[model samples]
Target: MTYSLQTKSIQCPYCGEQIEVIVDCSVNNQEYVEDCSVCCKPIIFSVASFQGEVVSIEAHTEDE
Candidate 1:
């Protein structure tokens, strides 16, 4: 099986900066934490993908 990845832009809840991230579209539902590229703060990610594309995504601060 081939793993699929998609690049997405998100707003950091901590710093309000636009961050770019890679999302794995092979999974249906995913929850993870990634640091903001600009602020270097931990951010929570909730992602959902359908048919090899990301259907939904949510980015949150570490405390939120």
Candidate 2:
């Protein structure tokens, strides 16, 4: 079944800036890194979802 999920607003670990990220749980668990909009530094995000509800969120920097 296809499902639509609301995007989440997260803070960039490097610059502490706000950003919007869309999460799709219907596909599966996901992990990726994106640049901070304000600082241009890389921020890693790890998300887990089950039954269309966010189960866990882990955000960290490369040095962390």
Which tens-of-lDDT digit does each residue in 1-64 have in candidate 2?
6885868888888777778877777655888887777787888889888878777777789998
Each candidate's lDDT (Cα)? Answer: 0.92, 0.79
Query: How many steric clashes does model 1 contain?
Result: 0
Relative to the true structure, candidate 2 reaches a TM of 0.75
Q: Could you tally the backbone clashes for each prediction?
A: 0, 0
> On a 0 to 100 scale, what is the lDDT of residue 41 in model 1?
88
> Alpha-carbon error at 36 in model 1, in Å?
0.5
Output the worst ten-in-a-row residue range by lDDT, candidate 2: 20-29
Please give the range of 10 consecutive residues that has the lowest summed lDDT in model 1. 55-64
Top lDDT hit: 1
In model 1, what are the clashing residue pairs, if there are any? none
